[model samples]
Target: MSESTNLREPHAQLVMAHGWLLRGRIWQPLQQQLEPQWSCWAPDLPGFGSAQRPPGLSPTLPAYGRWLAQEAKQRAAGVPLVLLGHSLGGSVVLHAAALLGDQLQGIVLLGCGGGVYQRRPFARLRQVGCALSWFQGDRRAARGLLLNSTQRRAVAGLPKLVSQLAMPSLWIGGGNDQVMQPVYVRHLAGYAPDHQIEVLPGAGHLPMRDQPAALAEVLIPWLQRLASPRS
Candidate 1:
């Protein structure tokens, strides 16, 4: 985790959502950047981080979304809030924002997946093989899921909903991100034409780790814009 900083002075509330296989602390770098201007809250997913997984709960994405929404609502208390989500968190945020509606000021999606693209049959087979391998303690399986197109499709419904979202949003992508390919970014732009996209050159899937400063530079401006009242 990045060094802790004073957040009370920012006067703006923030909610952060982490990517898969990662906990809330994975947002440390991004949090550090926004702390000067926002009081940030990063929560662990139901089954990940410090949060205990509910027994018999389905591990599907919608279940995660519902859990996150309930948690964010308790934390937000109807205050206008800023939401920043990465990868899996991106889908979670989309669902939460749809539920929160006008209560949320804006949303930022980093290295998000889900698109109209379809994976080949062989690719699906490969993904299942890799998932099984990972279950069997193959470290390579972890890397395979991170790079698979099938995983991207699993969350495609998110962007469709986000497109109709009334609030402003910023869609950021790492220039070299393998997980959410450049084409996916374009697809996102097509869906949410009102939103802006920031591409960090030479960065990868984890831009918060690879390019913290760049992420902050883009994020700060968007947050400020959101805070400003429209004429």
Candidate 2:
């Protein structure tokens, strides 16, 4: 995990999880926009960016969830934390929530959700993933991440995780996100006990890069609301 360079006293710690095949630094623009107010930490998950996959670390969501939960806890040092995850990372957060318990103040899911496994869509996704792996830079971590995402059990377990969530949550979808459509986002949000949903118009899958300010605009007010009672 890495910390924001800014020195201001943070309102709360924000730990961001990157999507599959992406590195922690991908959150740079969003972190920059949120800095001074939020103490942002974006870790390069094993096998991506500068991090190496540990010898026994599996490619499944539960394993990754354990890894993230530990990392978030150590970094937080008892401070309240808000977990923000994008795409596959959102699924990871769902798995980690139960493990985090009270240390987690809230969760934010961006461009991620799926309770039902559409065989055709998943097949197509695997096909695209194969092509990307073959043509793009070779990273063993990419293969593992893709494997977890396409698995039926993993995708099907998302709703159960959401249903079990005891903390507040915010689910956001890109108006133009063809990858994880608004329909899926809404579907998953329905399972949450306490949740709010929002859409960023004209933004696609990578809104952190394409619409950082807009995403932050939605996040700030929500974080403030969560902080009130604790304050």
Candidate 3:
């Protein structure tokens, strides 16, 4: 068994990006599981949680992508960080990785991956996601984000980015996830080299909320892998 790490004074920083319409605090359970080994900081994606979409900034894919990379850099303070992002945030992190260059140590994509969405279900999700955001009072931001996301053609570029990556990558999914199903997660593994993939048994789309312990059960081992030198 691996030894437990101290909660305070973590050895490495873990910059977490939560899913759309979700706040950073959702990562609290997983952060606890990662304590001592990783100092975790989960940031609210713009238009979600306490963050607001700035004027003239459309909540498109690129917009969130830019915000995340900048936020992670500022928060890390010159220290390289491991980026862990969930759902839509998962997609944002990959785009951000392109700009981060070598400062990014690694990436862990949770409950998200690239693949063609099965039309109807995805449309339903878009409707629900957009409605929820509007109800929350960020109509324009939510609508724009949802519109851009529904264009599945953009998915093709997702794998290409992972293929061209400079560091390690890990992809995880909840076994029972209805959104961005595990099969899509499997699709990502096809493109990424040295990519690690795991599925938390019986978990759903929001594993960080539903099965954080199980999410962490496999998560710690993967973090340990980051410590070992890779060829």
TM-score of 2: 0.92
Residue range 1-231, candidate 2, lDDT tens digits: 134433356767899999987889989999999987789999988877778888788877888889999999999998998999999899888888899988899999999987998898888888888667654343556777787778898778888889999999999999999999999999999999999999999999999989999999999999989977763
| Model 1 C-alpha lDDT versus the unseen true structure | 0.71
Q: Report the number of the highest-lDDT candidate.
A: 2
Better of 1 and 3 by TM-score: 3
- lDDT per residue for candidate 3 within 32-98, as digits (tens), equals 7777667889876676777777886777877778887888888888877789889878888878888
lDDT of each prediction vs. the true structure? 0.71, 0.88, 0.79
Off by over 4 Å in 1: 1-11, 121-156
Sort every candidate by TM-score, greatest first.
2, 3, 1
Clashing residue pairs in candidate 1 (N, C-alpha, C atoms within 3 angstroms): none
Which structure is stronger by lDDT: 1 or 2?
2
lDDT of 2 at 90: 92
Assess candidate 2 and give its lDDT. 0.88
**Ten contiguous residues with the weakest lDDT in model 3:** 1-10
